[model samples]
Target chain A: MRTFEHVNAPDVQTAVALLGEASTEAIAGGTDLLGELKARLRSPQRLVNLKTLAGLQEISYSPKAGLRLGALVTLAEIERHPIIQERFPILAQAAASAATPQLRNMGTIGGNLCQKPRCWYYRNKLFECWLKGGDKCFAEDGENKYHAILGADRCHAVHPSDLAPALIALDATLRVVGPDLDGELSLEELYTKPTESRRQMTILGPGELITDIRVPIPKNGSRGVYLKTMERQSWSFALVSVAAQMNFAGERIADARVVLGGVAAIPWRARDSERILIGQRFSEGLAERAVEAAVAGAQPLRDNEYKVSLAKALVKRVIIDLCSTTD
Target chain B: MATKAVRAKKLKVAIRGPGKTAIKLTVNGETHELLIEPRRTLLNALRKDLGLTGTKKACDEGTCGTCTVLLEGKPIYACMALAIECDGKSVETIESLSKDGQLHPIQRAFIAEDALQCGFCTPGQIMSVKALLDENPNPTLDDVKRVLSGNLCRCGAYPKLFQAALRAADLVRTGR
Candidate 1:
């Protein structure tokens, strides 16, 4: 890792002010940022440590106000919280399926949401992909198995967070704090594609920090499920994952939110699939149709065509599993 | 909103600028003070500065759990953690498990079941298991598998390791 100054911020405002300095980055859990620094992907002059900041480690919940998760809450806490496991099973399942026990204990939820892509090509310092200000994306033509199938224009690297898809499916909102930008935005707004001027995954401005995440209370008759498939049994990134939340009126679906991960630059919200499921009676055949609509416009690369089918299958499985459960 | 008010209080911030800083860490119930660069990892500090070589460092990255240690009683990869960030924090390594030269129950179980082949990953695997068994005395088979997933055993002693973990749980529960 490159040599740099380290400062423990007293609070959020000081943290934001320190990050506004030249070539400075925020360090929360240091699981992803430290790895990036060691790999020479990023060489910041200073690191503003956010672990010392108070009031960002609490996890509170209420039936009226829903769930409020401080940015510094570790993934292990989420996986073990009784309220999350019972009320928001999808989020708990996503947290449990991520990385491993040791990493989960070290990785915070806010850091997990802002994690960089896991593409081998992007991670390697030899090849600077378009996202890294290079000419072309090496994954576009070589070793593109783990690349994205959706929202892949300038970059084909897929988003690696398992929690982001589940949180988006739950309609979570993030409280962001910065020098001039301090407000709440839906979780979906946190992600963006690589545009002409912006070659990043998220639209977070420099010096901005995610303070906390707010998840809305599930409807009276709603339930959610998360399903992920990996190359091995454990400790591997998701090959394809689906998070499905459905509101049912008796035996018919009233509302649905379906999101796919490991198949897009962002957590790909399956609006078409959601549209197909609402107001329809839950059945195996309907799930198949919804899965078809979910993968309608996927443009898979040469080595990732199997992801489309895998994502579709996971979508179907999650929807079916959610419908089969009673509450 | 509440954080804004707290920010206005002008809290004394600990800023370690452009130079080495003195950091105090509590390792294995002993306090140690060291002056080091901010870029130094806790794993290196433990091995070099504190002379605690029981904790192995296989993959410097967070992937391999060979550097597993307990930070505030939660298992975390030491290689991924900065020594400066560990100021005033308690860290328990593999060296702290045994007391008065008597092997810990988990250590005894590992020896009895022959869970280790080459023993390169034994320290890390033992630390992870110790953390799990510390929290959950009666861990299920799935719990053992999930907790040790990060610790890679190239010797492929997973079945024997699993048996040892179960045996350790039984021994601890019965006070054997």
Candidate 2:
């Protein structure tokens, strides 16, 4: 890692102020940022240590207020929290399924959501992909197996977050504070395709920092499940994952959310798939239909057409799991 | 760079180093003060400066768990943690395992179970086991596999490693 000045910011205001300067970035658990630093991918002149900020490490939940997770809360903390395990099991499952125990102890939710893509071209200093301001993206014609099948614009790198799809399915929002941005923004709104103008995945502006994640309490009789298919049982990124949340009223599904990861530039919400479930009764045939709609418009690259089928299978399994037995 | 960190309030939060700066680290119940660069990782500080090299540095990045250590009683990759960030925090490394020349229970169990080959990954593997048994005295086989999955042993002594973890649990329980 390059030698740099470290500032342990005493408050959010101070951290934001420090990040406002050029070539300065915020360090939260350093699980992701430190790797990027050591690999010489991004060398900031100064680092503002967000760990010193007060009140960012607490997790509190109430029936009326839902859940409020401080940005600094580690993934293990989220995975092991009693309320999260009992009430928001999908989020807990997602956290537990992510990286190993050592990493979960060190990685924070904010860092997980903000971590860089695992694209080989992007991480290697040898290739200057378009995401790094190059003329073209090598993943387009090269080893494109892990690239996105849906929402493949200029960059084809898939979003590598496990918590993102789960949280987005639960309709989570984030409170922000910064010199350029402040207010609450939905978790889905945080991700955007990397455009030529802004070659970054997230829409966060300079000095913007995520303060807290707010999840609305699920309505009664709601079922949520997160299913991920990886090459290995553990320590592997999801080849295709699905997060399905639905509220059952009597025999009909009142509301539904189906989000897909590892198939898009962002946590791709399957609204068409969700529409097939909501306002309808669960049936064996209905699950197949929802699964079909989930991957209807996917444009897979040469080596990644298998993800299309994998994604459909995962979505169907999740829908079936959520609607297996109605109370 | 120094001027950017100055603020009207919170004067106690000083900007430390583009160079060496003073910091305190508590390792194995002993506190030591040293001057180090802010970029110095805890792994290097333990092995080089403090002369405590029990924590191996196999894959320095977070992928390999050779440098695993307990910070505030939670297992974290020492390589991923900065020494400056560990100020006033307690770090428990592999060197702290034995007491008064008697090998720790986990170490003794590993030897009894013949759980090592090259022994390059033993210290880290033992530290992870110590962490697990500290929380869960009687872990199932699934729990043992999942926790030891991060610490890769190229020699593939996984069967014995599993036995060692279970044996270490028995040793602790029986006060051996």
Candidate 3:
């Protein structure tokens, strides 16, 4: 409940300029930032509101320009958009399955992508985990049944978004804007590990803002699916999730993008699984092999040994279900 | 020395606007003006600021639906919403459902079915049921379950809740 200055930015440029000149932070829907500020995880001298900016709320599609999802597009809009559901069912499924109806109505796609991690220790502010610039990770030795099982060195927290792994599988690109600067980068290049830098998880520079996310029109004969396993049927993060996209030619997998969530420091992509399915037909056996390959190099901590097995099982289920999908 | 210097050089910026922001909102049907800080959540501003304590604040991080309220006729988590953001919108809390001390149809149905145990989650459940009935006057048992999944009753009153919602739907359809 601390006092902080608030300013409403009417445009991206003005918002960026405001951020550059003062100790400011952006507030899109305030679903995440306000909570974080209240928890004292972040202390900004000023809050730059992004809700008034026009044209940042549209969800547009083109055969040429692909799908352009603006920064302020709510999760409900993404979930219910006909074109998104038809063309990119993976994204739609991930969006529709997030949090709950009320959260989906208020949470913006940009905020969901840019929101901080949901690690219990990190949010509590009392544990001082390694991801929070502290020397130790409490989840490393504590109750880590939800921690990562892949791609962990010094930190083992899993990526919290169910949409992020699906977006990675769709080969989406991100467009970021800041003061006098604008650029686009693939979604793969957007995330980095805590081992790489303890300070930030994304490649966005300090004043940079995510403006839009674009997904190229995938070629014909492409099919994708997102499957998640949670302890509860609703209102909980995934215990393990998989986003599988299979490009097939006469039942043989021509191309595949297999990304694993709830099991890594980043959205872990299983390149080995992709390599194994290059010419092989996707069956229950092949799916099992892919799952084995997906969790091949996992080094589970003391309390998170079950994540590796759970991740393998979810990946196998997703691939099996995806193979059953028709063009 | 360093802390004192930092505090001395800091500008006196009013975090909220000059004085508390006066937000004029129409709750249910009545208009009211309330002074709230920029950081106060809509749930707090409604309950603490205006003394409308019908909207509960359980699991304030948007997980539980105890604080569910209608913003311009759409259900949203009141805790995650800012007070200033509701300036010109119509907010409907649980207290607004009763007309001249008569319980709303959903509230009456809930009581008739004994759908509440401790009654902590009753208001949110009733508000959500109101929204569901507003959209779909005749909802199936599955539809009622889908809409009420976000509202959790620790006492396990879901069977009664489902029955009450079904009964409310029937009443709304039959005009009884």
Candidate 4:
């Protein structure tokens, strides 16, 4: 690991001031940042520690505001929270399926959402691909097995978060705090198109920090589910995952949101499939149609042709499972 | 000579890697205060700084759990944790399990079951199993497999190790 200054900040104001001074990075729980630093992927001048900051490890809910998840709240806490388990079981299920029990105990929600890609080329510091601001994207032709099938232009890397798909499916909003102002923004707006900036992720600026994630409670008769298919059962990233949440009136779907993970540069929201599902009765044929619409026009690389089929199969499976689930 | 005296002038300098930070950690009911570099991992601090060498280091990249230790009664890969970050926490290694030359029940069970061939990964496996049993004493076979999946043994003693864990749980339940 490289030599860097470590400053523990007791409050967000002081942490923001420290970040404003130089090339400083915030460290919450240090589960992801420390691993990146050790791999020589990041070399910051200073590390601003946020563990000492009070009131940031909260997982509280309000009748008016719904669920408020603090940045410092660990994945284990979210999985174990009673309100989250009752109201948003999909979010809890997603949290429970990530990494191992030990990693979940140490990894915070903010770190999981803001983590860098797990691509072997991007993580290996020696390879300067397009995502790393270089000209060539190595995954375009070379070893493109895990590359994106959707939203692939300059870069084809896949989004690795299991939580983002669930959060976006629930129509969540993020509360961002920056040097200028603080406000709420939808999770869909947090992601940017791959063509816009190949190097940057969310629309968050340099000095902005994610303070909390607020998920609105669904109306009555709403059901949600998150399902992930990975090569290994534990301690591995997902190959394909689907998050489905729908509001049902009798046997027909009223409103629905479907987000696919591990298949695109961002949380790939299945807008066409969602539109098809609305005002339609839940059945095997309906799910098959939604899956076909969701995966249409997919552009798969040489080695990742199976992802298109795998993604379609997962979407159909998850939708059928959700339809079978009772409130 | 005057030249010799001038050449002997003291030059106070500090040459350290990333500067040394004082961290106080408790292990096995003993508190140790030591100066460690910022980049020093908990595995290095345990074996090199504090001389508690029970925790083994294998696949330092966090894949293998040979460096597993209990931090606040939860098993974590020591190689992935920085020593400086655990300044005010409690750590438990395999060395702290026995009392007064008496083997812990888990150790006795492992011996009785002949759970070791080379014994290289024993400490970490024991620590992981201990942490799991502490939390869930009567864990099912599936639970045991899930919790101990992180730790690996090259000797392929997983079956015997599983028996040892089950025996240890029985001992804990029966007060044998």
User: What docking tier does model 4 reach?
Assistant: incorrect
User: Which candidate leads in lDDT?
Assistant: 1
| Lowest lDDT 10-residue stretch of candidate 2 chain B | B1-10
Could you tell me every candidate's TM-score relative to the true structure? 0.96, 0.97, 0.93, 0.92
True contacts kept of 3: 0.47
Q: Interface Cα RMSD for candidate 2?
A: 1.8
Candidate 3 - CAPRI tier? acceptable
lDDT of 2 at A69: 95
**Model 3 per-residue lDDT tens digits across residues A1-327:** 466656667677767766665456888888888778878887776677787789999999998988999989998899989999999999999997788878888888888887787878888867777877888878887877888888777776777888889998999999888766799988888888876364556767666888999998877888898988888887778888888887888888888998888887678899999998878887777777887899998888787788888888887877777777785
Tell me the lDDT of candidate 3.
0.82
Task: State the TM-score for model 1.
Answer: 0.96
lDDT by residue (B1-176, candidate 4, tens digit) is 23322322221111123578788999888899989876788889999998888899877777778888999988888887778778889999999989899998999999999998999899988887898889888988787777777787889998999988888888877877
Least well predicted 10-residue stretch by lDDT in candidate 1 chain B: B1-10
**Candidate 2 on B10-69: residue-level lDDT in tens?**
446577788999989999999999899999999999998899999999878888788989
Q: Where in model 2 is the C-alpha error above 4 Å?
A: B1-13
Judging by TM-score, tell me the better candidate of 1 and 4. Answer: 1
Which candidate tops DockQ?
2
Q: Which runs in model 4 stand beyond 4 Å of their true positions?
A: A194-198, B1-17, B114-118, B154-156
DockQ of candidate model 3: 0.41
Per-residue CA lDDT of model 3 for B1-176, tens digit only, reads 34422432343322354237777888888888888767778999888988899899888888779999988777888998888777778999998888798877888899899999999999888888988899899899988987887788899999999999999998888876
Q: What value does the lDDT take at residue B112 in candidate 3?
A: 95
Q: What does candidate 2's lDDT look like per residue over A48-97, in tens digits? A: 89898899899999899999999999999999999999889999999988
How good is model 2 by TM-score?
A: 0.97
Interface RMSD of each: 3.7, 1.8, 4.9, 8.7
Query: Against the native chain B, what TM-score does each candidate's chain B reach?
Result: 0.90, 0.93, 0.88, 0.88
